[model samples]
Every structure is written in C-alpha cells, then in structure tokens.
Target: MSAQHFVFLLVKNHTHLTLACATEPLRIANMISGQELYRWSYASEDGVSATASNGSVTLVQHGFGALPPCERLFVIPGLGMTDFITAPLLACLRRAKAGGVAVGALCSGAWILAEAGFLDGMKAAIHWEYHDAFAERFPDVALVRSVFVADERHITASGGTATADLMLHLIEQDHGYDLSIAVSDMMVYAGAREATGEQRISLQSRHGMRNPHVARAIAIMRGALEEPVPPGSIAEDLGISVRQLERLFGRYFNTSPSRYYMELRLDRARNLLLQTEMSVSEIAVACGFQSLGHFARLYRKHFGGPPSSQRGRIA
Candidate 1:
C-alpha cells in the first residue's frame, strides 16, 4: 500500500512532548512493519525554524507558503497560540481544507482551528487548562472533556501523550490492531487511552479528594463559575446540610465552603485573564463578581496581584 503522508505546522512555543508523541508513533509503525507505512514532514510559520516551550529548536522542511501535499495537516501549537493566528496561517489552513486535506490540531492548536471556523458545531478537545477560556471564547464549538476527538473531519488531540493515542488510533485504522499494538509495545506506551478517555483525573481521585459529596460539590462549583451557586444550595443539591458541607470542606481544604468556592471562581478568573483578551471588568463579571472593585481586591488578595497584572499569555 502507498504511504499516508502527514504535515505538521509547528508554531513557536509549541510543546515538544506532543510533537514527539505525534511523530514517534509513525516512526515506530514503520520500524515494526518494515515498510514506509507513514511519512511525515514539518513546517513553520516563517519557513525557517520554530522554538519549543522548553527552548529546543526545530528546523522545518517547509513554510506556510510552500506546504507540501499531505493526507493530514495538523497544527501543533503551544503557549500564546492566539498571537500566531494570522491571516496567512488561516488562509493556508482554509486552502488545505478547501482542497480536501483533513485538518487537525494538537494541544492548544484547537484554538487556532476554532478561530479559523473549522470546529464550529464539531466535537473537539483541547488541553484542559484552556477549557474555561476556550468555552467562553467559542461557544459554537462543542468541546469535549476527552483527550482526543477523531471521528470528525477535523481531528484534535488534547496535547501531551494524547497525541500519541490519536496517532495510534489512526495506525490501527489504516493498518490493523496488531501493527498498532506492536508500535505501542516498541514505544513502551502500554494502555494508551481511547478517544473518549477524559483528559483529567476524576476529582474523587486527585489530591486526596475521596469524599464523593465534596467531589460533587466541587463539580457544581466548577460548572457555576460564571454564576456561582450559593453554598446552601450546593449543600442541598448534595443532599447534605450546610454545616455538613462546611465540615467536608474543612476536612479537605481547611477552609469554609464559601472560601473554597471563592478560590475556584478566582482560579477561573485567572485562567480567563491570562488565556483570553477579556478585560478585567468583563472577567470579573464572567466570574460572578458583581463589582469590579470587589473582584480586583479579592483577585489581588488570592493571587498576590491585581487581575490586570495577569494580562500576559502563557509562553
């Protein structure tokens, strides 16, 4: 069979782990199969080279102006992805999609796809840290909690090792389960997660949060970040007394339920502040604060800086 080709557009500050995870699977597939099952190439926005977040540099085989033909074109982006969403990049992607190339994204690259209008009404996944801001910015896109989404024409992985999982899924589809499993064995990637596997650990498992009621309460708190529910209401929903909820919070967080809820909202506010272009006042309102002054004061107290000071995007 003919080799399936893949092209990756590497934006600056892209995470090296996901990039490696994306390509290494293909390499292993070829090694195990003893044939060129897959071919891959790299491109950069400038047609020169791009630097990863960890300071490693990668020279590219092409640039946007000269992207080679491929079966799949994946955008591999990292921090500050919004800044790199330029006309040229979007146009290149649009042309590829228009010409029937399957476009995909890795890591926060889904943000780029959303910006280019590729993921509207599509099931997509992105790195969990960017969920709140991404949801706020692109309401039309249906973002799933899964590590990857593969059934759509525009594929996406939530980054990190999830890229490997997506690649393995493709290998299994094109070749067979045996070759994919061999590739995984060759790479020591046992038990790669399926497409529907969640990106985060259950709240009940992480950070010693063993109490189911507390976990349920935290889930409600996260969902209501934009319009926080009252502690009494959360307790009632959990079928427990308000004082019982407070005790649970004290046991796990050593704080009042209200204080823990405040921290959750502040954390969301911080994510929006750093990952989005939303103004402090808008973020304040988005995080359920009625008064900008109050938001700023609490933000400063919780984060050791005013919301404005958190303006810079992640690098």
Candidate 2:
C-alpha cells in the first residue's frame, strides 16, 4: 500500500505539546516498520512560520492555498483560537472535506472545524476547559467530554497527551496492534489510553458520592478552588441544610465537608508542586490557605512531607 499523507494545518499560537504528541507516533511508527507508512508536513494559511503557545516557531512547508493532496488534514491550534479562525482557513478545510480528504482536529482546533459546519450533528471532543463555552457556542454539535472522538469523517481530540492517544488509535487502525505497540514502546509510552476515557474525574468518582446534591456541592467546591466558599453557604446554595450536607458527607465519604475541601485543596497544591515552578507559599495562597504555617502543617499531615521538601523532590 502507498504511504498515507498527512498535513497538519497549524495556526498562530498552536499548542506545541499536542502537535508533538500527534506527530511523534507517526514518526515512531515509520521507524519501527522500516517503511514510509505515513508522511506528514506542516502547513499554514499564508505559507509563513507559525508561533506555538510556548513561543516556539514552526516553519511551514505548504500554504493552505497550495497544499499537496493528502489523505488526511489535521487542524492543530492553541490559545486565542477564536481570534485565529478566519474565512480563508475555514474555506480551505471545507474545500478539503468536499474533496473527500478526511479532516481531524487537535485541541481547540475543533472550534475551527465546528465553525466550518463540519461537526454539525457530530459528536466532537475539545479540551475540557473549553467545554462550557464550546457547548454554548455550538449548540448543534454534540460536545462530548471524552479524550477524543472518532466520528465517521471528522476526528477530534482534546489537547495535551490526548493527541497522542488519538494518534495511537489511528496507527492501530491503519496498521495493527503489534505495530502500534512497537511504536508505543519506542516512545516509552506505557500504554495507549482509550478514546472513551474522560478528560476529567467525575464528581461521583472523586468524592465517592451518589447523592446528586452532594455531587453538585463537590462540583461547586472544585470550581472555587482559589476562593473557597463556606460549607454552610454551599448547603444553602444547594437548598439543603448544613446538617443534611454533613450527614451526606459522613455517610458516603466518612468525612466532613471542611475536611474534604481541605483534601481537595491539598491535592491541587500537590499537582502545582510537581507540575509548575510556583513557590510553596504562592501555591498555598492560590489554594486559599490564609496562613503559610497552617498550610505547611496541614500539607505535611496530608502528604507526609513539608511543601518545601516536596518541591525539592519534584524539582
């Protein structure tokens, strides 16, 4: 069989991580197979270099108006995506679709596809942070929270490592499980995540609660990580008594609302510690801890180490 051609249509401020993940699988697949199983190139609307979200620039090999015929074309975009979608780019995608070229998107690039009317009546996936806004803007599209959605013609994946998952899925489809596994091993990837996996933890799973009110209350807490509301206020907002809320928490989670909230904040602090360059005190303040001493004490009690020590280990 001939090599499958792919063109990644990049936009300004494209997500560098997603782009790398999406393309690395193909490169690995080719190396493992010792064949040009997949060929890809970067393209831009005006044949210019595109700047990534991290300020990295990618030189384009093709302009949208002068793209080489390809089996698949993927739209990969990043932050400020709403400002990047233009008539010419949408027209190019629409024209490609009309010519029977399979189209896909990574990250918020699905927003451009939806604007082009290709995702109408289709189940699409975008990064979870944009779920509410995308749903509100594209009411006709079925915006799912899965890591990626592989519809008949339009494929969409949420950003980050989800792009890798989608690309691995496609590799398996095009070649076989053995080749896909070989490529994954070469990349040091543990395993490919299923496309149906959720982008975020469900409230029920996070809090181990079945009661709708309790789940809703926890969701509220998650939404207000930096500015926590009181448990009494949470109960009032949920139209339940504070005693009832406490009872629900005690029955299901075996913890009080205050304790659960503190755990959630600590979990966020741990993630920031491992993933970001923010200082311990900044993380404490960001997680809504008023006193750094109290934050350190509770953090050690919860995580079995001081925040400073945790940062040291992570760094």
Candidate 3:
C-alpha cells in the first residue's frame, strides 16, 4: 500500500490548538515508528498562509487549486464559520470529493464541510454551542453531539482534547495500538478517549433545570422544527399560560419567551449558513423564516452580516 498522505484544509484564522492536536500525533507516530506511515501538507483556498484565532501564522504549500491526491483530508477551522464559507474553499472541497478523498472535519470545520454540501444526511459532531443551531440548519444531517463520529465517514469532533482523541483514533486505525500507545504516551494522554466516546454531558442535565415544564417545552420546540409553535402554544401544551411561560423564561434565562425563541431561530439560521452549502433562501426556509429578507435582516441584527457575506467568510 502507499504511504498515507494526510492533508489539512485550513481557513484563515483557524484555531491553532486544534491544528496542533490534529497534526502532532501523526508527527509523533512517525517518530515512534522510525518509518513514515503518514505524511501531510497544509492547504487553503489560496497558497498563502493562515493565522489561527490565537494569532499564529501557518504557511501553506498548496492551494486547493493545486492539491495532490490524498488518502484523507481534514478541515480545521475556528470561530465565525457561521459567516465564512467562501466559494473557492467550498469548490475546493467539492473537487476533492470528486477526486475521491475521504474527508473529515474538526472544531468549527464541520460547519465548513456542511457548507461544501458534504455532510448532508450524515451523522457528525461539532462544538457544543453550535449544536442546536446545527440541527436546525441541516435537517438531513444528524448532529450526534459526540466528541467524534466515525461510522458515517463524515467524521467530526469537538475541538480541544477532542481533537487529540480524533488524531489518536486515526493513528489506531492505521498503525494499531502499539503506535497509538506510543504517541499517546509521548503526549501524556492517559485520559484520551476513543472515537466512539460520547460527549460529556446529557442535554437535559446540562440545562440544570429541574422544572419539568421548561424541559418539556424545550423538547417540544426541538421536535417541532418545521412548524415552530410560539412559546404560547408550547406553554399551552405544557399546561401553562403565556404569562407563566414568560415567568419561567425570565426566571431561568432572564429573557422573554419571544426573544428567546427568536434567538433560537436565528441561531439555527447562523448554523445552517456555516455548515451547509445551501443557498440563503434554502437556509432561511429551513430555519422557519418565510421571507428571505426577514431572515437576512435578523441575521444581520444578531450576527452582524447578511447571509451571502457570512458564507463568504467561512470559505
């Protein structure tokens, strides 16, 4: 078999720590093996360079326009993907797929893959904050909320240590536990988890709301995505009046029910913009906004950009 060539599809201002966690284990595995089982190059839309969110510059040798065939391609991205899917990068990923590269995403990179239209109907994982919004955006893609999901081959992982876990899983798959163990020992990763590991918290428990009505209402809202009911309708279903719903939201969130729901819808819009290559009109409809102009207006008010600009930034 040929030596595995791993390539990273990075964007400007990707998270530096994630880049390291994604690549270093492979470097270590090569060191421990005394032979090159994996080799990699960095790629971006252009052949220029990228700065991590923390302000580190990484030089890129290849533009997506000139990338070589590779066994795997991983996209590493940082914040603001909700507004940054550039067409050039999206096309690059699409071309890579047409060339038969196995692709994966990390950190906010899942948003990029979704933007490339690569993650539809697949199960994936991503950072926790974007989970609700991601689900709302890509109804076809199942957001697993795991640290990593390997079965779909559209593998993704939450950032930080989860990035390390993903690289470890790759090492294990290619080189076996001996090399994975050596690299893990070198990295002092006794606490590292496998690809099949679940995310740390349950959704209900994370909310810390013992109040059954609020919990049930959240579930109802989550279920009724295509036809979102107002908090009043949800309240009625929960056996509470709208005034009672207002009190519950105020007590727990310090916000009114209407504002909270709006936030939820807009948040979903943001995720759809980042993760799927769907057009602005498509995303708007998916987020339950009947009017494209209204969706764009609310998106700007909340996230400070129109849908077109947001998608451009992620690329």
TM-score leader: 1
Q: What is the lDDT for 174 in model 3?
A: 82
On the 0 to 100 scale, the lDDT of residue 190 in model 3 is: 97
Per-residue accuracy of model 2 over 1-315 as CA lDDT, tens digit each: 899999999988899999999889999999999999999999987898888989999999988887889999999988878778888788889889989999999998888999888888999999876764575468899888899998547999998999999989999999999998888888899857898998887778876656899889888998788899999999999999999999988988889999999998888887667545567888888889989999999999999989887662221
lDDT tens readout by residue for model 3, 1-315: 457998998887788888899889988988898888888999977688887788888899899788888998988878776555787778888888888888888887787788677888888898876775566566688887678887786778888789999888888988798888889999998978866666665445776768888777767765665567987788889888999988988988899877777777777767666655778898778778898888788888888777787773333
Worst 10 residues of 2 by lDDT: 306-315
Cα misplacement distance, residue 142 of candidate 2 (Å):
0.7
Q: Model 1 lDDT vs. the true structure?
A: 0.92
Q: How high is the lDDT of residue 85 in model 3?
A: 73
Of the pair 2 and 3, which is ahead by TM-score?
2
Question: How do the predictions measure up, each by TM-score?
Answer: 0.94, 0.70, 0.68
Total backbone collisions for each predicted model: 0, 0, 11
Query: Residues 100-171, candidate 1, lDDT per residue (tens digit)?
Result: 999999999999999989999999999998998899999999999999999998999999999999999999
Q: lDDT winner between 1 and 3, please give it.
A: 1
For candidate 3, which ten residues in a row score worst on lDDT? 306-315
